[model samples]
Target chain A: MILTVTLNPTLDKFYWVDHLPLSLERAEEEILIRARKSTASAGGKGINVSIFLACMGVETVAMGFLAGHTGQIILRDLLEKGVTANFVWIEGENRTNVTIIEKGREYHPVKIHEEGPRIPSHAQEIFLRKYRRMLKRAEYVVLAGAIPPGVPDTVYRELTQEAKEAGVKVVLHAGRRPLWEAVKVGPYFVKPDVREELMVGDMPVRTEGEIIAAGKRAVEYGCQACLISHHVTGDVLITPEGIWEYEAKVPLTKFKNLVGADDALVGGVLYRLARGDKLTEAVRFGMAAAVASAEVEPKMCLAPAAIEHEMRAVEVQFKEGL
Target chain B: MKARDLMRRDLTSVEPDTLIYEVVYLMEQSGLSTLPVVDEEGKLVGIITEHDLIHAALPEYFDMLHSISFLPNLNQIQKRLKEMAFRPVSEYMKEVTSVHLDDEDLHIADLLIRKRLKQIPVVDGEGHLVGVIRRIDILSRLIR
Candidate 1:
């Protein structure tokens, strides 16, 4: 089974408003806009990857800390989505992230984030122990997203390092600090978005050339493959074997929800890798997954057959020096 | 040399939810006296040994019968063994005394001598299981 870690998983609550029933003029008006509906999903970087992985027919086990009622919902949602959970239970409740939106003019969508439970030293120890056991069972591990408070930034580095030492392949798509630390562990794959690259690598990315250079620098730092992705400019892959780029299809239509597209790419690539697909094939699969995800809102994950159809329009170019 | 230099990196462990019959099967297959019980994270929770299996296999009244010098009933013991097979290893796993990764060889030797330990689970400073130091590993290396 594939292993994914989401240290600070959250219960995301999305509230939709039909209209803003408020008076703009200086007049006494009853201000009330009832929420048309509210929906919740298991939200976290690792959880997102695991959900897509499971949807794509890969056996996946998502590991992390879950606490209280919100945590139980995360667990239940994962089960309902056919993703196996191996969460470590904690005392504090899992965090709840609320997003309120009104129509397409959601210019100021209100978002409330809760601080997750603090994982004590003993619990951290327990999690590390659990991770070790999981390594033996998992062929590929995905370390992603924000870590809860009390977890050292270097923890991701340690885990990736240990996993590499144990000869298991690892894929990391985390935030700045953990990504920065874990990149030095020489994982098989590292996917850092353009903004995140600047945030952690402390490198300026003014142009595509700068982004590609940063990815190359990350490769030099230790990762075998570094994928620097940007929505508009496209993705640059830096690998020792070769450097390549894949631009989004021209005449790109407006995106519905780009939130999970990156995760889909990560999961898509890993799915192929787990199934022993070559790197080039895996990259194409990932691009297809991203395109499929970007075109729609949070819906069904692109199956391999659907990805194959999506890949028809994708264009991959091999990039030499400059 | 410290335990890290001698400890074997090929650690074999089972989770707390592992079944008793499976543990017995693994132990019987590998000829190991015990298997360390680890949680989902590689932290050491407990250890299940052959003795624990034997203890659980016998009827509860065996302790009471031992002082009275009774032969006791053999069929009842067999029935108890069947019942115990369905239980999890966590039910009977013995609490383990582990050594840290940087522990001196002398300390490990002392523990082995006093506790009569055949293998010592080596944990790092953060309490993650790093490796296991077996008596035979030390003996073989010293002889080499």
Candidate 2:
């Protein structure tokens, strides 16, 4: 079973307008267009992973710290979607990440990320104890997203060590300090988006070669395999043997939202791994899921049929002498 | 109309491993003849009703092997009643008759009528328990 750790969870609210009211002097001066509440669901990297895994019939459990009414709603929704949840309750309300999407211009969506509840040091200890207990039974322990306040960056490093000691495979997905710290734990898989410049081992990763170098560097840090996802140029899989790059075969379709495709890619690959797929097949499967998810709405995940279609278009080549 | 539009969100269900004594307490308190059983993920896996309880509580019917006499063993029956109260409901709950919230109106209506069920648990797209719809909820709408 897959266990996802969402250190900080949020209640996401989406407000769609024809155009955001840039300025309003009075009620009459307000930009008048029909506004609607699109959707509000559980929001967190680990929570999304759990939801996607549950959607694909995987037995996934999501653990984290949540609080107040927002936490209650997130818990209820996650349970209703068939994902088991064991969340520690805190005193403050969870955060909300509001996205103001323009109807015709979702490409440039405005995101408002609130600073989540400030967790106490005692709560950190409680969560750590819970995570250790969960790691005993978890086969794949995913350390997801950013660490919240009062939780040190070393949290992932320590948990990674605990998971490694328990013989549970670890998949690390984070950026900057947290990612760098956990790199010393030798995770099974590390996904760094190559589209963004991720400084892995003091190297600024930009091009395909740099991305491969970054993956290789992660492998030096004790990662078994590393997956580098490119935004438009496609994705790459780096291992000791060779570097396999995948060019997406996505058909032309008006993408509803491509914002969460990276997260979907992680969920899809983990889903395949949980089912005992080989490393290569898992990467290919993940690429298919990523492309398929980008082709449709974020709510609709990549299904097998779409995966098949996307697979036909994806060309994976193992480049030698890299 | 969709099943979710009319389904009651306040659910009263139990886990598969809940003790029979607690099951009896919950059922009696809720006044429900049939109760849905869910897993840790809250997926509707089975249902335990008064009938299942009766089947366990009273040894009216027996699958007991190689009985010389047709007479009911009062001692054995009493022993079963006593032991069943502490046993887990996983062995008793029946896994049948669950509807998805997005199920077609005709299909859910037919399933309910044909099965002679008062209500059934409503599952979401992922087959997790969401709510329940009773016959009275439909009846009230039809009459109105």
Q: Distance (Å) between predicted and true CA of A68, model 2?
A: 0.7
Please provide, for model 2 over B28-107, each residue's C-alpha lDDT reduced to its tens digit, 9 standing for 90 to 100. Answer: 54456778887655567898888788667654555564342675556775677678888888988887688887776677
Docking class of 1: incorrect
TM-scores for the candidates: 0.67, 0.67
Q: Once superposed on the true structure, which residue ranges of model 2 sit more than 4 Å away at CA?
A: A21-37, A193-198, A251-253, A300-302, B1-144
Worst 10 residues of 1 chain B by lDDT: B65-74
**Model 1 chain A weakest lDDT span, ten residues long:** A250-259
Show where candidate 1 strays beyond 4 Å.
Answer: A17-33, A100-102, A105-112, A193-198, A250-253, A299-305, B1-144
DockQ result, candidate 1:
0.07
lDDT of 2 by residue, A131-203 (tens): 7656766889888876777788788888889899988999887777777788877988887543234576576
Tens-digit per-residue lDDT, A164-246, candidate 1: 87778889887677787888768889887543345436766556777677778777877778887755427878887778888
Scoring the B chain of model 2 against the true B chain gives a TM-score of 0.82
